[model samples]
Target: MRLLLIGPPGAGKGTQAVRLATHLSIRHISTGDLFREEIARGTELGRNADRHIRAGLLVPDEVTVGVIRERLARPDTEPGFLLDGFPRNPAQAAELDGILARTGSGLDAVLHLEVPDAEVISRIAGRRLCREDPGHIFHVDHDPPEVAGTCAFCGGELYQRDDDREATVRRRLEVYRGETAPVLDHYRGQGLVTTVSALGQVQEVLDRALTAIGRAGSTPRTP
Candidate 1:
């Protein structure tokens, strides 16, 4: 199924995207990963994005669109792909629409994982990471590693991200409310949005998401 997964930070969109992509046998295309790949390869688009990123400015929409276009053009995407972390605003959404139109394909569904702001704040604030691999996640209260200040896998130091600090979490939440929330309405109007509560165990939430999409009755199942 061609899908778009949207949610606030810490909402487990990344986790679900990985699982759903595997389940449905489709490529998982995350904008963040795309940018990282491009930058690592030092492509022209990557260089432009790096310039804006280093300046602490948002990468221009067209640059992002270019990366996405190239990704979607890949032959492996012919079956379908799951999109995460792109189309962050209405303009990007419109650009996506145009791109899909030109390619004669369109999204089948947009899954909006809804979680309360208070819960999101608490979850993010309690988050910790392994120093050796910052992406190795844990939660101080919810799911702490076996040893305090150390990674369970590699015994690396555990540290909290500055962005996961309470003060930074609030700012990120505010930005999501101001900028990302409106995209929900945009998809809603198109009758393509499936809202699923995202406040439960990760597997439970994924089940809920699958149920919601199944009920939508528009998504194709893998044969």
Candidate 2:
């Protein structure tokens, strides 16, 4: 399935993207990976993007769109692709429409993982990452480690990530809503949106997403 996955911060969108791409036998194309690939190759677009990113500013749409355009041209994308993290706003969404239209293809579904903003804040703010392995995570309430300030797996310091601070998370959520709402609206107009609750276990959420996608597929698209 050719799909666009949208979710706010702490919505578990990353995890679901991996699973959906695998299950559907499609290439998972994440914008972060696209940026890394460009930067690793020392492309001009990457250099520009690096400069802006280092300044804690959003990368210009031209550079990001250029990176995504190249990624979409790869051979693996011929089968299908699941796009994550691209098209953060309506303008990028329009750019994506143009890109795919040039190839005479369009997204079959736009999977929107829905979760309350308050819960999103709680989910992120409660997270603690291991000093040794940042991937080792524990939630203060849901999955706290044996010791309060230590990583159970690595016996390392467990500290809340700066981005996971409540204030930071709230700001991120605010930005997400402001940027992402219109993108959702754009797809909704095309009748491609498949909304699914992101609450509950991963498997349950995945099942809901699949069901939602299936239902969207059965509906006729607008011209």
Q: What is the per-residue lDDT of model 2 for residues 1-223, given as tens digits with 9 covering 90 to 100?
A: 6899999998999999999999999999998888777788999988988899899999989888999998899888999999999899999999999999998888899999999988998899999999999999999999999999899998999998788899999899889889877899999988888789999999999999989888978865543
> Which one is best on TM-score?
2
lDDT tens per residue, model 1, 78-111? 9989999988998899888888888777788899
**lDDT score of residue 131 within candidate 1:** 84
Model 2 CA deviation exceeding 4 Å by range: 220-223
**Candidate 1: where are CA atoms >4 Å away?**
130-137, 145-158, 219-223
Report lDDT (CA) for all predictions: 0.88, 0.91
Give the total clashing residue pairs for model 1.
0
